[model samples]
Structure formats: structure tokens, C-alpha cells
Target: MAEPTAPPAAPSLQELQHWTGVLGRAQQMMMEAGIDMMAQLPAAKAAPAFPAMFDPAQAMRAGAAFWTDTLELWQRFLDPAHAVRAEESPEHARDRRFRAPQWREDPVFDFLRQSYFLIADHMVKGVDSLEGVEPRQKEQIRFATQGFIDAMSPTNFPATNPEVIEKIVETRGENLLKGLQNMLADIAKGQMTQSDTSAFELGRNLAMTPGKVVRRTPLYELIHYAPATKQVFETPLVIFPPWINRFYILDLTAEKSFIRWAVEQGLSVFVVSWRSADASMKDVVWDDYVERGQIDAIDTVRELLGVEGVHAIGYCVAGTTLAATLALLTARGEADKLKTATFFTTQVDFAEAGELSLFVGDEQLKMIDSLSSDGYLDGRYMATTFNLLRGRDLIWNYVTNNYLLGADYAPFDLLHWNADVTNLPAKWHQSYLTDLYRDNKLVMPGAMQIAGTPIDLSTVKTPSYIQAGREDHIAPAHSVWKITDHFTGPLRFVLAGSGHIAGVVNPPSANKYQYWTNEAKVSSLAEFVAGATETKGSWWPDWLQWIEAADATRVAARGARIPGKGKLQALADAPGEYVKTR
Candidate 1:
């Protein structure tokens, strides 16, 4: 009997149907009321009149109405017994003492209170305006009344105090509206941070495996590139990435990785991953980055690969160092070993450095001098400076989205990669800012010297590919393109899309962005400017073609591998550990 009674068929179909009908009716009623209220909205916006609504006298009477409605609603939802229990909790007690709404001191709270009065004043004026209305117009009046009442309803405010919510609505209405619009625009721009590509995973996988560290006599790593065929080039390719960051920018990820792409294209590639400098490296000047960093890497690649000479690629700050190194090599009649050189978004002239000019002025320089007096530029300082350049998009946008919108935006691996910043040696930063930015001395023939030798770009005859970014704020395209004037050999100037990082790490797949090329045979920037054609497609293909043409002839036979080791040591993988460190 108990089993028979237990089920009661768990409410038969008819009972369920009845309940569903009730819910449907309730929903329909709400919708009808909402529609009726919305119908009363003005066909056209009314003209604005200052001091016509929410006058101080009207607000006083309105405030009384809001207080009465708010207290009734609060009492229903928040029982006095529940409040007493909540107060018993230590967390609640602390919040009540320190975080409770202090209307007197809080501007936001005061504004919300004022909004309550404003609503009441408007309601009174609406009633007064309806004095001459006929019986048929009574329905329309009721609709309008309902609309205003709905807007100021206690249920509309998420907070217990309706007055506080009202104040917030009044005080922050325009700003909140503007913020919402901006957020939508950012979403459309795809300027929002995104996850690093699947290619990043491939690169990370390659670099994490165990490998050998074959230290050259002086310094540097001779990374071997094993191609499909024995018919490889006579000249080795050595990549000199700046010590300012990690070397991985060249080899970023598999797809966008320039180093990997070169290897696939049949060019043997060797990238130098500079060691993180320690406190002892404070005295290590710009010369050390060139002679010791790039030159040493070149020699190791030559010896390991058994090539006649190496083709060098310098990126950003590394490019400048390479220019200096080339000058020194040329002065000593040692430039014959080098083939072609490529500079990616690198600046040699500093006079028109764009926004960077502001931070490198006299007062800023003095501050930097004091900070870097201990020798190495602190990494945090450098990161702060770059972050400031795009503060709205990079910093404030995230703050609003995360805190205000309560959006847990997924962290982009690339952004995470960017945030993992490394410190610069004090000597390098101080000398760079003063000599390059402040003094504008690098482009001059003998204005700057490395290792006591006057460095000059003209002396080095390596054909060059100088690429700049149109949207790049860090190194303006003009400042970078000026390098062509300093070089006597054939030069190709490319202007790509996006900022400094995106422009350089650009993949061929991102074909939406384009580059411009000056007319053929126009060697100088001025000539290019007059005859430049905006070309579609990625600059990577163009750069690859240029480098391939400039490359020295490939040997008929594969040169013998350096004799010393039978099984050469292998690098761990693609994205090495050094690149992963912050």
C-alpha cells in the first residue's frame, strides 16, 4: 500500500501540463505589460532643456518616494534574522565595518542617491503635463506611467538600496555607455589578445627536448641545420637575435618562425641565443654584444658547418650591433667572409624615432643614468616604458574587462610570451639611449665605434634587406628606412603592416596585411617614396626571394662537415628554454 501511494505517478502528464500553462500565462502577462510600457516612448527624442527636470525642490520629494519603496523591498528579501546570522560571521563583520556603503564619503554612492530624487521630480512633471488629457488618452497615460514606474522599480536595482543604484545610474550613465561602445569596437578590431597559434606548440615542443651545448672556443652556439639533400649552399646562415629579449623572435613558433622557414627553404640556419647577463655583466658594453655575441657566433657557425662565410640576419637591437660588427670587420679587411645581411624593423638613425623621443630627453636620461648606475638596466623599467606606449589597449582595456565586466579573458600565449620579459644589462641600455636616441650618433660614418674601431655601414659591402613597419611606433619606418642611404650596396626597403612585434613575426598566412616596395633601381629612400607601390600579400615571400637572389652560389658538392666530431651535438628543439624565461 505504501509503495502504491509513494509514486502518485510523480505528477501525471495533466498536472505537469497545468503547471506549464500557469508559467506560460505568467510570462505572457509580463511580456504584454512590457510591450504596453515601451509603446509610450516618444516617437522622436525631446529637446534638451537644462534645469527643467530634477530641480533641487523636485528631488527632495522624489527621494522620499525612493526610500519608501526601497525599504519595503529590502525587508521582504533580507529578513532581520538572516541579517543577524550574517553579522555573526567574521568575514561579514569585517565587511560591515570597513566595506559598508559610506554615502557621505563615496562619490559614486552620493550620485546614486541624487538619481533617486531626479526620477521622482520627472514623475511629478509627467503627472502635471497630463491634466488636459481625454478619457481615450487615459490608456496612453497609464502606459507612460507604467513605463516610468518600471524604470524606477526596486527590482531593477541589483543593490538593496534603490537610492544608491539610482545615484550610480545618474553619475556614470554617459561614461558607462561610452565604455560599452568602446568594448564592442575593441571586440570587432580583433585587437583583443588571442592565444598563440598551434605552431607555437610545435616550436615549444622542439626546444624542450634534451640536447647538447657545444661551447665554441670563445663563445656562441653552432646550431646545425640538416636538410633533405647533400647539395646545400656554400655560405652558412647565422642569425643574430638581440640579447634585449630571447633569440626565439626569429624562430618564434614553427609557422611564423623565420629560422625554421629558412631551413625548410634549403638554407642552413644557425641562431645565436644570447646568455642571460648577470651582475658581473654590468661592464659589458655594446661592443660585447657585437664582437663577442655576433662575431663569435659567426665564427662558430663557419667552423662547425665548414662554410666559406656566413650570411647574417640581425633583428631589432641586434641589427644595429651587427652593423657595428660589420664595420669593425671591414676595417680589418675581414668583410670578405660575410655574404648578405638582413635587418628586420631595425633603426640605425634616431632623429625621427617617433614617440620614443619623449622618453629619451635630458631629464629622462638623467633618471636612467641614476637607475642604471649599478651597470645593467633593470628589466622591469624597460617593460614599464614599452607598456606605457599602448597603455589604453594593453593595460586599461584589460582592467575594465576583467574587473568591471567580470570577464575571465583567456590569457594569450603570445601575450604571456611578451610579459615574460628579460632585463637588459645596464651598460647596454645607458649607452643605447644616450648614443642612439638622445645623441642620434649611430648613423654618422664614424660617430660610433665598437672595440676602438670606427664603425661605418658604407665600408661593409654586404647587400641588405631593410624592412620597416608602417604602424610601428617603437621604430618609425622613416628612421629604419634611412639605413639604405648609409649602405652603398644593393638594398631593398620593405614596409610591412602591424606594430613592431606583429610586423616582424608576421606569417605568410596573415595575408590581410601588406607591404610597399619602391620602384626597382631606386636605391635611396627618397626615390622609393616617390615611386613606391603598395603591394598585396605578406612581405615574407618578397624578403625570401630577395635573400635567395642575393645569396652566394651553392656549391656543386656538399662541403665536408667540420672534421672534429662524428655525431654533432643536437639542439634540444625549436623553442629553447632560454626563449621561455621571463
Candidate 2:
């Protein structure tokens, strides 16, 4: 027996160039027809800020530094000793992009990886080193620069990426052919595939919690999950997931479903499945969401069960509005309408709103208005904007896996939910940014109004629980903690580990991630951290304990709201009509 001959040498640079061009054409098809991804980023449409970011004086010094690094890198590349050795710094070791053994063992690839980082570092610091530029403009430039660098990673390209090159060689160019096919399939689907969507469905595998849609309106479907326990708490619990995505994220799977867990633990759960916005909802505004969407749900639920107040949980943008709804109820002398409020990774004080704020200025707003049709912001456009938030993980990772390596996406419940994007009323979306994100007015007393009532977050007396993700980019934990400044109610703030989705969707059964807790009121986030105690595992159990302790009264299973002829009419099954709109 003899070993198989070694595969042919990696594809030539010229051949790689052809594949790169094919990739460009492939991406053109992935975006939804008649939608422009660039319209969301007005800054990107303007001329390059070579002069502003790197004025002539600064450019010269940066150029000299770059050339010096390039010469040193070239010299090392020519020498077998340094070229053959991997860049073994702790920083490089942590980069997932350079984790492949070929990046270290192969000389040519190692040089490319090191050179790319060298250039990326210089580019980032060039803007940081600028003296006279406005802080906002400088920040925008820095974000754009980093996005460009992430896009041009050696691993994203064919010729430079050792793993991609090897895959191409091993497959005898079949990978490239299959990659094009994947691109075409994604194009037909109208967005990039983040997971094996075919493997999951709402009623069968995902959002399978036993429940029924008790109420339906033009804007939302109110779902009342059947009592898993024999008895339920007196105070009914309602959840308002962010309208930007589907509602079923909270009820992904039986084991992972937060809704199911809450119900099984003896709490009655009701969730608002917001209607996917269309041109007919063009007239909808911020107050409409507060009045018709959230407040209405609360009103109906209370009226049905003859309950005085409803316990509320809001996640992301929904949490942002739920805070305002509390204030609105207060202004109307109906503060008691809501018994308690729980916010998950929500931002009321946008002072530290993070990267999402980068696209909330005048130019971006006006461009969105113009791009909208019948006063509706297309879901596809919004999806692209969000995916760019962590372009490397959300966008480029799939680019390399599905296209470069010709691999299929794994079946991930969360990613499947992510790809099922929802549209928003243009008027409402613009006002959300202008009021909360851009102006930072939700915290200010009487700064904004909902349904003619002033929003004074300080007057919100409802006992509150706020949970923020420590590693969350969308809503930074520090910003979430700012809720403490205004709310006079007894509040418990817990900082959970991981990013936005992972942090919030965590279940006790998974035993994944950790959370921090502090009892004393602190002036700054730093102080809160200093006085806090760290506990390992999911924060869900902690939240359950906090909410459960407040409402201990129990009712028989028959007393729980069951959809039927006597009670509210069953609109449809759980993961109802509105959730399946798209």
C-alpha cells in the first residue's frame, strides 16, 4: 500500500482574484431586491475622509510609520527563521481569525496575518491620534475603519487565507462551485442564512410551548401560555419582546424556553406577539406602541382575569418602551395599573448607548425616510444594518463558512430567529431614535409625551428589576444601570455574562454564564461592580426568585386564563397568527 500523492499547490493569486470577483457578484444577489444597504449609513455614501481623519500633517507621520513596519515585515518574510515562526504574541493567540494551524505553520500565511494586523493597528491609531477632529466624526471614522479592516481580513480572502486555499486545493475547485450555489440559494431566500432554518419551525421544534393566542389586534397577538403547573400566581406575567425581531425568541425550545420555564414554575405567562409592520401601519407612531400595543395588552389581560395590576417584562426596545409605559401610566394616575416592571438589556439613558448610536444622526434619519416606501422601513434593510454591528461574526463568519469553505449552516434556534426579521413603521422608528437614542429624553422628566401624557421616568413608582448583559454591545450594562438614577422604586440590578441574546436567553438548566449582584445604591457603574458579589450560572433563576418573592398568592389552575367559549376567544394556537405573519 502507498500513501496518496499530495494535493496540487494552492490556487494562484490570479485564480484567487477571479474567485474574489465571483464573490462580489454573489453578494449582490443576497440583498433583497429594491433595497439599498448603504442608505442606512449616510456617512459611507459621502466622500472618504482621508483629509479629515488623516490631515496632511498627520498623514506624513503615519505613512512613515507604515513604510517602516512594511520594510521590517518584508525583511522578516525573506528570512526563513522568522517567516516560518508564528507570531506567538498573546494578542494574536486570542484572535479566532488566526486560530488555524496553517496560519502558524505555513510561512507565507503567517506573514500575511502579521502584516494585516500591523496595518489595522496603524489605521486605528491614526484616527485616535487626531487632535482637532470632532469627537462624533472621529468615532464614526474609527468605526468605519474597523469595519473595513474586519472585511479585509486575510481569512476572508481566497489567496491569502491558508485554510480556504487548502480547502480549494483538496476539493479540486469544487468548493468554489458549491459556494456560488449557496449564494444563489441565499439570494432566493432574500437574506443571508445564519442557520439551517429548514430544521426548525415555530409549532414543531421552536416556540413549541403549549399555549393559545387569547387576543388578536391589528398590531399584535396576545398569547396566554397554558398553566404548566396545577396552580398559578395571582398576578399574571406579560412579556413584550422587541418588535425588531420575532416574539418566539423567549420560547425557543421546551428546555431553553424562558416562557415555558416561567409557566412551569407556577407563574401565568402572557406574551405580546407584535404584528410585522407594513404600509397600512405607516401612520403608527411611538405613542401608538405605548397606547395600542403595550398598554392595550396590559388593559385586556387585567380586564379578562379581573386583576388590578399586571407584572411586566420588557426586553431590548420593548423594555425601553415598557419603561415609558410605566411613566405614562403614572402620568395618567394609573400607575397602579402595572404592579412590577422588569427590564432586560434595555437602554433608557442613551448617554452610553454604544455602537448602535453611530447610525442615529440627522443624515442617517433623513436617508431612512427617503428610502422608506409608503412610510415603511423594509425589514431587509434593517437586518443588514444590524448584521453590520458585529460584521465579523454575523456577516464575515458565514461568508467564509458557507461561501469560502462550502459548508452548510448548522441548525441554531437563535440564529433562525435572528434571520426571521420584521419590519417597522418608518414614523415610529424615526421617533424612537430621535427621542430615546439620539436625544436621550426618556429619562428626562416631561421631555417627551406618550398619548398626550408627559413621560416622567422619575415618577415611575412600580417596583422594578433591571438585568443587563456585561458583554452586551447593543445596550451596555453601564447604561442599563442608569435606570437607578430616576426610579424611586425598590430596584435590583444584576449584570449577566455574555452578549445581548446569550445573556438574556440563558436558562438555569444550561448552567452557562455568570451574573453579578449588588444591594447598595451606587453612584457609578464602577462602584456597583466594586461592591458586587459574583455568582456562577444563568441569571434566569435569580430573576425568577426576585419576581416570584413579590407575588406569592396562588390561584387554582381553573382560575388561570384559558382560551375557550366562556373566556376570551382563542385567536389561534401559541406562536400565533401575528408571529407567523412573515
Candidate 3:
């Protein structure tokens, strides 16, 4: 008790001053760190003049209007009784964020919230006004700026976020703890583990369609889905999905499976299940994908079906590969192997290949080559690039749910499929990036080569049905339309009303999206889109109709179409070992 009465006096003035100086130094260090982070943002060469956006007066007018609205919002927030209704912008909505009663009714947060939007809007304007920069550089700048803005979002921090605060209080900080654990777990994996692996077992719940692996090569396995109809079409349908992902995207679930729907429609459906490339397959080049991947699948399908003609489908990069294969086959006078061809979200002309083209510059290509010293493009690298293309949905969305809210995202089949990625062979990926993406070579007649054959897409005379996604960033609709310019055959082009995956995976039953069709082939994409009429429901039925018209003879579908019949032996069950590897 006596010692407590003589409690230690306050620290000496010198000690207090020293502690103050230490705190000041710590703040200076933090500020320096922040400046370093900003300095590390991607750099770009100046772009050409921004159109009308370069006028200073116009910018000032916009700034004045923004400030006026901000002042009004502030005035309303200052009022005691009047509840200020937060303005909702399309890209960055704030009112919808702080929905909890405590936040919605509070004036203090209202001011903080609107101020963020105003500042973000200013930042975007500044980025948009950037002139004399290359398109890739511009994209990098916009992307970096967006990352910064998203990081600064109040909703990401519990102290500034009312919703997170309420969640913390209600859950007694369990949410924060779970979020930290989730973050640490992802950091340990060196990648964002987007889906709950415990929630899905590949062969059982995901790629459960019943079929047989009719043939296998060093590169892929060909799976023939069991026919769900009593009679099947005479011309067998072979699909060449992009090697960047597993073929099961077309067979993700029974109800939504494009293969199942085609099989049900009485078409003998065969999918190319591309093997996830490893260091062992590093020598595999684009020719291998063409010859061994698509060409081999076609040959096996012909042997199994005993039909000289087969209908072929290619999606995204596979569309490019399939087109190349068909061209090579046509050059070799073996074009009769495929009766008809359908391209989904494919880009033969890379002139307008959308945002993904930004990653194919000289520096990026060198980096990729260095990475491929092991002989394959890492699947995680490919996945990360694709995620950045749609950062808001694929990156930030998962980040918020998994790291901020400490919650598991609702189990989504598409999200699961997206998370599942495949590697590209080093030689193959290098050729693809250089020839297709960088040089825009495939569109040029005889500019590319495969299996010692000079490839020219114009020689690919297979009757084609080209389907594009309206919002596809990987393969823009404009780029897909350019394929029509290269093809000499009858081309039926349609635009589905969704992005890359959604546009193709759209099943008729969902009735969730629409499509656009124009029978007349126009010279420009604008004309095509203008003349096209929007049709409700999925484009699958229309595509089926097109393929069906190519070969109308229907035979009795008594048994499931297996792969190994005459020469090729049955390798394994459907969704073979290749798809389950990674």
C-alpha cells in the first residue's frame, strides 16, 4: 500500500520528448512505405491525345458539378432530421454497401462514404485523361488505379466499415479471426483458393457425366458422352475446348452440360480432355496441340463412328487450334474428315483481341519465356492473368467475401470450373503468344505452321457456325467477326448476350441470357450488331439446329458411343485421367 501511494511520477521531460520523436519517425517510415507502394505502380508510355476529354474547361465543368453535388450531400448529412439518400453510381455503389440500420441512419458515415466516391471519381477522370500512352500501358494504369481504389474502400476495413463493425460486435470478433485465418491459408498456398475443395469431389459431383475415353494420346483423352436419346445424328460432334482449361467445362454438370444437351439431342458428342501439361511435356508445341490434340481426336472419332465426316466445335483458344487443324487437314486434302465447324468465342484475327492482348507485349513475352524454361506455362500464372481481366468479379469479389467478411462464397459451379486451370506447354504457349496474340499471324494466310504444314485459315472450307460473346474480353466479338473475313465457306455468326464463359456455357433450360443473330454477313462488326435481332433464351438450340442441318440423317441410338472400337482401345472412363490431374 505504501509503494502504491508513491506511484511512479510521469516520465521525465527528456524521455517524453524522445518517445515523441520515435513516434514521429515511425509515422515518417509509414509515409515512405506508402510512397514506395505508389511508385511501384505499372508504368506506361504516354498515349496519343485523348479525344474530347483533354479540354481543361470540360474537366473543370465536371469537377464543379461533382463538388456541387458533394456539397448538397454534405448539407443533407448536416441536417438532424432529414435522412440523406445516398446517390448510387453504376460502377461504385455506396448506398447499397452500408445497408445495416446503424450505418444507414448515421450522418457521420454518410459524409465519409460520399467523399470516397467523389475522390474515386476524380481519380478515374485523371486516369482517363492520360494521353500519349499505349493501349497496354493505359490498361495497366487503369488496372493499378482500380486496385488502389478498391484497397482504399472503407468496406474493406472494419474500423471504417459499419457493416464489418456490426459483424464484429455481433460475432464477438470471430469474423475477423476467421478472415485472418483464411488470408493466412491463401498466402501459404501462393494462390487464392477461391472454392471450398471440401465441398466438391471432381469425378463425383463436378464432371459426373457418364461416358468412355475412346482414345488417348500424349496430349489429351477423347471422351464420348453416352447418348441420352434413342437415335443419334449421323455426323458425330467433336468439341475442341481451349487447352488453357479442362474440357469438362462443356460437361460441368448434367443439367448445364453442353455435351449432355448435345447427347440428349441425339448427337454423338466427343470432347477433347486436354492433359494438364507438366515439365515432361515441355517440348510439346502448338503443332502437337493441332496434330495430336484436335487432329488426333478427329481421327479417333472417325474410326469409332465409322463415319468419314464429323462435325467439329472449338471454343476460345481451342477455336483457334481447331481452325488451324482444319486448315492443315484441308491443306493435306483431308478436309473431308470434318463436315462442319462451329467456333465459340474464338479469335482468328487478334487485331482486337481485347484486354488479354495487353499482356502479350515484348516484356511479358520474355517473362513468359523465362517462366517456360521448365517447359510449360504455369497454370497459376495463366489463372492469375485471366482473373485480372475481370478483377472486380473474379479477384475483388472473392477477396471481400473470403478476407473481409470471413465468409465462404456460395458454392457456384462456374466459379469452381473457373478456379480449375490447366497449363500450356512451353513451346505451344510461346507460339500462341507470339504468333496469335502478338503478331496477329493466324489471320494471315500461310503465316503460321503446324506439323511442318504452312497454315492458312482461308483454306479451312468447313461450313462454319461462329458464336461470339457480346462482352467477351479474352476474345472480343469484333475479333471473332474477323474470322468471317478469313473463312471462304458459309459462316453463320451469332452473338450471345454474356461474357466469355457464360456466353458459351449457356444451357437452354436456364433461360437466363439472350443472343443476337444476323443472317446477312456484314463487312463490319458494327453493321453485324446493328442488323442482328436479339433472341431470348440460350444459343445452344440455334447452334444445334445449324449443326443438325449440316447432316440430317438420324440413326437409331441403341447404345452409348464409346471411343475405342476398331483400332483405338477404350482408355478409361469419361472425364478421363487427364482432366482430373490438376
- Please write out the lDDT profile of model 2 over residues 309-339, one tens digit for every residue: 9899999999989999998888889999888
User: Model 3, residue 172: displacement in angstroms?
Assistant: 1.4
Q: Report the C-alpha lDDT of model 3 over 417-524, residue by residue, as the tens digit.
A: 877878888887888888888898887877877767888888777899999899888888888889889989888999999889889898999998899998785888
Task: List residue ranges in candidate 2 displaced over 4 A.
Answer: 1-57, 82-89
- Give lDDT per model, in order: 0.60, 0.82, 0.76
TM-score of 2: 0.90
Residue pairs with clashing backbones, model 2: none
Question: Each model's TM-score?
Answer: 0.62, 0.90, 0.86
Q: Which has the greatest TM-score?
A: 2
Point out the worst 10-residue segment of candidate 3 by lDDT. Answer: 44-53
Ranking by TM-score: 2, 3, 1
lDDT of 3 at 452: 72
lDDT, residue 76, model 3: 57
